[model samples]
Target: MSFYDVLARGDDALDESPRRSRTWNFFSHITCNTVVGLSKIVLNTLYNVEVKGLENLDQAMVAARKENRGILTLMNHMSTCDDPFIWACLPWRYFKDLDDIRWGMAASNVCFTSKVTSRFFSMGKILSCERFGRGPFQPALDACVRILSPDNTLDSEHIFHGLGPSTDLAASMAKNLKEERNPLSPEYKPPVLRKKTSLLHVFPEGFVCQLRPPFNNSMRFFRWGTARMILEPTVAPTIVPIFSDGFEKIKPEKVEESAFDFFTFYNRGGKVTVNIGKPLDSAIIDGFRDEWRKLCLKYTSLQDSNRMSDELKFGEEAKRLRSKVSGYLREQVSKLRLQNGFDKEDSRFSDVNWWVKYTDTKGKSDPSVKFVGLNWACRDYQSNVKIYDEKGNLLQERKDALCGPKAPRKSH
Candidate 1:
């Protein structure tokens, strides 16, 4: 079937929303196919990018196709360009036609103030414009309903992404799909031997939180949303948690939609690689959050710990992450209720002194390796509260609790 046949039909009421039809979308198959073709040309020859899990994808797809099933490739969402690049580098030759590489994109109406923004992103199925739509925006949700329908033939792929920390891509998918009896749906009612037809791409970090040197490890607690996709028992696609290194080096603001998201000219230029791990048994995700977090941390540290200090590599992402991490610190402090004594809220939450949680990888149970988050206390205040690593050996002895909005230059 033609790729056009695979995309979701926007709205049936041509009389009402004439502009919403896939045909009327001036950027039609010719334009999109040409666009995907150009994507191949630029991605193949442009920069130093190495894909690790492509072979795994091929093997999975072969089995999936034979079984008439679908796939859910969960990954870390770092930069916008990263998704297109990942799709572009897939083992498309095995799929017969490269047009099958297309998937959905999730973005907010941040730029939809103008018609140009709508047209630029209108090529895809969903044209979301709900800022706080998380509550009760019907139209935004109705579009999602059609976009993620369980009918195997309607839409072949969906790219799931969340805007901020609160953005729950996995939750949104699980909840909505649950309405259709997703495998993880508590009230899921399974169909008898039905065929599967879509591929789900998800990044579990929630948002691209900024991270600075030393503590640059991704705080990926795969403890939530994603697990629901499989736990429901109604639908569970083979889950692959892809680990990508070298992408954080590229900034987002520099990524232009016109360039097909490659950002070749703007990027200072560096190698970006994605290591696709094995497809996970959906059931294991439920109890494996802690297990996976340790694994993610280990791999991240072993591969890119040195690079974490190389803030220059991440440019805008680093700046953004640093701001986020800094904010995260304040948020944690606020959660601790340290700031409630004050009247209103401090515009500069950083003004309140708080110690940074430094992961000291010194003498520990895991032996010389593995990092844990901790805040230093002065020698005097270090009394009954003894913080040790996995091994029960005191990593840092503090005399007093350090409280401040910012960590001292010497402390970090």
Candidate 2:
């Protein structure tokens, strides 16, 4: 039978039992495959997307598979569509198992703002996490630890909200951890945990940017959670670096507000370029973490932020290192971007007012851009594809320029 027919069969509780797992498994497999397929076409046709460093990704995947480990993709966030776009470009050769082994951490405020959105994202293996809260007590870190931990200890006990709870607070918190019910009200069944996945994607910047002025000079600094994930012993996920640009060119309606517009998605066109880098050697990342600690301890503020101990006090050094780590990772990403010919000048895109008004000037008062299928887009446009190694050195390149007029111009 068709995929949707099978999917409709499991419309009830997704986690009811092992039978449900198989049902949803079949569903997710079909759905993600469809998404990837459509993404390939839309990305190529509408955006003229290009990719490099497949060899680097392939090598890392090989090593990860050999060791039965996971790869943590560290990326620069430029737009709301960043996560799905990356997944679309990920090499299917490695993820052929289709076991939903990929995961991404999404901002809680954005992803879980409503039940509808929460359900849509949960299917994509996206974990909702709080962006701002007390330091040394991050819920995101706890979530990451659970997903990466092979033994699954973090899942059993919820991480306490704040630093230290008093006698009464401690008892209440302990009880909350032992239950499998909603945190706010005990009567509700806890949402089913997202399926087990290995590869975790994170945009450490904590916020999306359109490369506007002032912030245009450098990629925004990232949080320390990525570094923390790398240092964790549970998965010790290899750090894979990816650089992507051109999403801003679409200039979607209300993009500045960060709301996703499906019309703009279907009608957008621009060249997107991505470069994947080799997994940073674990030894190198570990060594950097060690050096970071020494610097933190030497400075009281840094030490407090490190949360190495409860008695430590916040000091200036911690603040400095926080900025330092952010800059270091941004620089690495910038290097990849530069290698692939992306610079600050090409960081943003805007739609002419006349163009925006022209798309739906007739019957549809509001624009309703239909997603032209991926195959149609690919068949319509010529694409240039390349593969590279860990060093940002090219290993292979291919270009297919079918005979056809270029993608329609989006603006006057």
Candidate 3:
């Protein structure tokens, strides 16, 4: 199949068969090494890097490995280089097995826009995900769930038995692979063959937020996809919160021209700090998971339930529960920001709507608001807002196009 076809498959690009190809694995090894090496140079030579609480990461890895559980590392997206560069803080042993390395997600529009870039990122083990299109409900998130809780019954032999060198057939098989049922379904069952798991790193913010001082370290509202990864997996993945600062300085939103720019990396000599918080309390997670399962059964039995629509499946109660879980996870990262000597963001920042409202009211009063990252925030909000006025009349006459097709679905 053509590269466009592969890109069109979205999360299906993460199938294990093609990744298992000897040739593909060889290149992947090289690609990962080169990227990580460059990241080391950037972090160590070009910029001063300070990493704290590494023991927390080490301990979590050990525990996850021992328990055969997946590890989900959540961090704030400060810059484009956060992924590979962040791994620079890790020891050499972590890079020894490329399979053991973290699998991350990247926007398809940016990373898979062309064949060369698509192949490069795929080999680097980055899953292509939709940002504005599918939002959190994309199949890529489901792929993440499977990655975290892989079925062990299908061994190398079973996977490659009939498939030969033709990647097309392999891709077909991977596409047809059985999918896990909605965890909220009463009939939902965990994979009986599950035994192994993988590590996934996510920027739950879903977009970069390069705020100005005092609030620069603040994170956007964590997306519900993170909650899905946590709530749907058969075994609760070890959730680890990571906080990093100074990457914004390394690759600031705006670049100034200078003769020295050619000689130096972006804003050279900036200090980058990465703090790894302890794996969140498993008991707390389990409590949330149990409550989620009970709610699922409760919603499924409701007379008014619309099973086809995700919004009506679990109803408003599920949305609130998911928001609670997602909000709590964001709070953990926020706490790390505070611990690292950054000022606490206003509690209102936790509300997704608060940013848009602030932009429309107080933000519009200040012309410099765009300089502080509110520009992208307002743009994102506008993109997701659906207007019910199919006719031109209301849109043209209304001063504020606040009317939507329907009540806004509560953030999960």
Best by lDDT: 3
Identify the superior model by lDDT, candidate 2 or candidate 3. 3
lDDT of 1 by residue, 1-412 (tens): 1011111122221112234344544443344455556655656665577777577776776665555545656665555455555665554452333223333334342324356655554443224422211311123322322232343433213222111223343333334442332333244222211233445455443334333443332333221233323321112344555656555565442211333444443344567666666565434443333332233233322222211122221235433333443343223323322222223333322321221222222223223222222111122212222334422244553323422232222221
Q: What local lDDT does model 2 show for residue 201?
A: 76
TM-score for candidate 3, please give it: 0.74
Better of 2 and 3 by TM-score: 3
For model 3, the superposed segments whose C-alpha errors exceed 4 Å read 1-13, 153-196, 255-264, 300-314, 358-374, 378-412
| Worst window of 10 by summed lDDT in candidate 3 | 1-10
Clashes of each: 26, 5, 0
Please report, as a residue range, the 10-residue window in candidate 1 with the lowest summed lDDT.
1-10
Q: Best-fitting candidate, measured by TM-score? A: 3
Instruction: Give the per-residue lDDT of model 3 (tens digit) for 28-114.
Output: 878888889888977888788889999998889889878867899999888767888899878778877766678889876557677
Off by over 4 Å in 1: 1-35, 91-99, 111-113, 125-196, 217-228, 231-234, 252-269, 282-412
